[model samples]
Target: MSTDVAALTPAEARARFRDGLHVPTSGWCAGYAQANLIIVPKDYAFDTLLFAQRNPKPCPILGVLDAGETTGPLLRGGDIRTDLPAYTVYRDGELVETVTDLSEHWRDDLVTFIVGCSFTFEAPLLQAGIPIAHIDQGCNVPMYRTSIRCESAGRMAGPMVVSMRPIPATRVSDAVRITSRYPAVHGAPVHVGDPSRIGISDLSRPNFGEPVTVPDGTIPVFWACGVTPQAAVMESRPPIAFGHAPGCMLITDAADTDYLIP
Candidate 1:
């Protein structure tokens, strides 16, 4: 007999993470907002924020925590240092380490920013009767670094990264309509039909996450991914920076409906 892990509320889920749970918690914490996290020293905060603002398609700004503050005032009461399941620490653009907790490296001059995530838009896609192949296969969403260039901000600039889903041609418009309501979380499809159009030469391989099958009658659809910030930060080669590991997002108390602006 198999026992299912108990579902966790947003606050409880965050507490579980702080208590040393480093696993992906996306499907577990339903209905709440899940975000891509970025942490950088105060010196680079302005430049990073500008980078996100300028490339809103890939780096949608959700909530920014002040330097020395761990909790997000606008998003939730959650602690930034502990709420995330896993964190990737980068030194001079190279991934030096990954840790479950950031308390040891926490600094008074460090600031935290939570960007919108595609997970926020997935709910509506499923609701609209579209099938998410990767979710069905229990694998991570496929992500790619495109030839697309993001507008530079100071020293922060790099190629746009995108998350892909194979949707049936008939339902592509439905996917677009459902996701369009949530602009803050990379709304709409960037490219459809041809992967080569966006510089993705192969469909079976991706730079990040596992690739899913592109079944018959289905076409690959792309969206601006939160991972774009991670790529940009790496190119900028900051002395030290932190980001949530791909697929392991920071769950917030905010509802997806709240993100839809009229």
Candidate 2:
């Protein structure tokens, strides 16, 4: 019998991903946290760090692995290059290719930054009776590059990216209150309702990830996304960089409660 993907432990989930099970990670490892990945040469590490510091909403960092290091407290007994379901490679401001593993591209000077992902807070949202449309539809949460620009650091500069979830109008306040408690993982909705206000012309056409259905009476909610770093990478034209494919995050051993306030 096949194991339930949602019920798998963090390590088990990563093991499957390491073995080439490609899938979005929004609803996996329910209570554990999920993180976004960004790898860059050490020469550019300081800029990446500063970028996260300057734009905490969209780039709150969970943990950073030293240059050339992989296994760490957040992801014990695993390789950073292969643990995530999928990875996007970039070169000189252009998305080059995506791969399941980075063994071939690994370099001694590369540093890995694990940024906070909103998916970490989804478990709490579900526990509070807020429905996550992507999870319900078995698809990736919709994400788009917003007109809001992040506070840049050194060569790191780009527009902010956001992930969208449709919340029932009746529960929008509850959704905001619940998520506001976890600032480390994108605290609250950046924009609620009206996608065009943020420069997103169509909900059906997302810059990244798959679009989810917005049920009637539900208002669209947008959260700062960790993919904001990848947007910077693209804008800055760093010679080389790597990031987790949107919605395909790294399932960390850390509990979601670690980021929960109160």
Candidate 3:
């Protein structure tokens, strides 16, 4: 049986998100930009911001919240405390729990940062006739940690993480051309063809997300993923860190078109 798509206005979607909803958010609240979120203590905020700026490919900076502030009025005027559907809380670099609300754990010295996600580019890829295998199969895109190193910032250094999509060899160039327009959301392909060249030994076993089919005529293409920041956070093992649960993103007021520069 087919599932009904959730009908949520932008406001309603934000409200649902804040209430701690952790379900996959794709195809819901269309036309809005979905973002990856990262929250850290005030002491580490500057270093994290610097890390994001230094490694824009995998950690595009979207919006930042001042220490102790939960509402990002400049970006969405939505309450960060309760706007996202789900959150992952980490302590000393370990994932302690995943929750819907941050009210109880909210601290006066906390700062929030939103990162650009590849979901922003998916709409355009579909529009251009590129098939996203995971979307077609109803699964999350496959992600892997690579040997590629990210520029270090304080305690935020780690290997880059990337998301993979299989594309017809004939359409590989087209996918790159279309996505390159939106550099903020990890534009263009990082590697196409051999997965092992990037240290991904097995396509069937991804570090995060599910693997999708790669038909005989298709090749696997990789892109910098927002998960890179989370991985960095994990490696850094800060006292406390928060991130949007995988596949659960912050639907923002920004239009996808705004990201296209050319």
Candidate 4:
């Protein structure tokens, strides 16, 4: 397997996952849009949609599938149950298991929400010469559960989750300006510098994903994470919910340029 992951099309990458390639999808299919997944029973669908509506930064929805519908515009012919590299299953708010496929867990009344992912903007960030530590380190980006709570929507209420990247002191502004153009994919940094201010006491350990090396001259920058829905599921605990494992996004057929604004 000497394939270049970044060069593969979204369909090809998804095919690999369907065949059991389980891995975090941060840097794969470099020029395409990626998405976070959140599935809930039809009973909680409205509450979940309202949650995303109330919190756009972390839950910017790309496309939604009807109850029991698997494929849609964002996915083309792909099946949500088997397309992503990994899936996180939550049982009554408790993370039960992580799996490569969701075939066994399928339900007739389930609705899937495809949320925009920060990885969609990483290409532009790299083009602008802003280093993304996790990609360079070949690991999952660090994600932390912050002290800040998101605006509540019905039974969906929980703390905001954030993904961190160490930006050099000099290019922090450049990173912000470049990313702000892509609001659909989490836009700019929410909180820059001093992770402690947001209740992250240790950079070495993250609540989700692997921590990266933060150089001496680099300042840790955070963007609202798509993982916030998973947090909501944890706190609110609907009967059962499904999400892409943090950083293991569903690579969409849409081009990254589609989300960019002038």
Error of 3 at 163 (Å): 1.0
Candidate 4 has a TM-score of 0.98
List model 1 lDDT by residue over 14-130, tens digit each: 888889887665465556677898899999999999999999999998888889998865436777888888999999999898899899999999998899998877767777789
lDDT of 1: 0.84
Where does model 1 exceed 4 Å of error? 1-7, 74-77
- For candidate 3, the per-residue lDDT at 64 reads 88
Each model's C-alpha lDDT?
Answer: 0.84, 0.93, 0.83, 0.93
Collision count for each candidate, in order: 0, 0, 10, 0
Better structure of 3 and 4 per lDDT:
4
In TM-score terms, candidate 3 sits at 0.93
The parts of candidate 2 lying over 4 Å away from their true place are: 1-3
lDDT of 4 by residue, 31-96 (tens): 899999999999999999999999999999999999999899888899999999899999999999
TM-score: model 1 vs. ground truth: 0.93
Residues 83-161, candidate 2, lDDT per residue (tens digit)? Answer: 9999999999799899999999999999999999999888888889989899889898889999999999999999999
Candidate with better TM-score, 1 vs 4:
4
lDDT string, candidate 3, 190-214, tens digits: 8998988988999999887787887
Instruction: Supply candidate 3's per-residue lDDT for 51.
Output: 94
Q: All candidates' TM-scores?
A: 0.93, 0.98, 0.93, 0.98
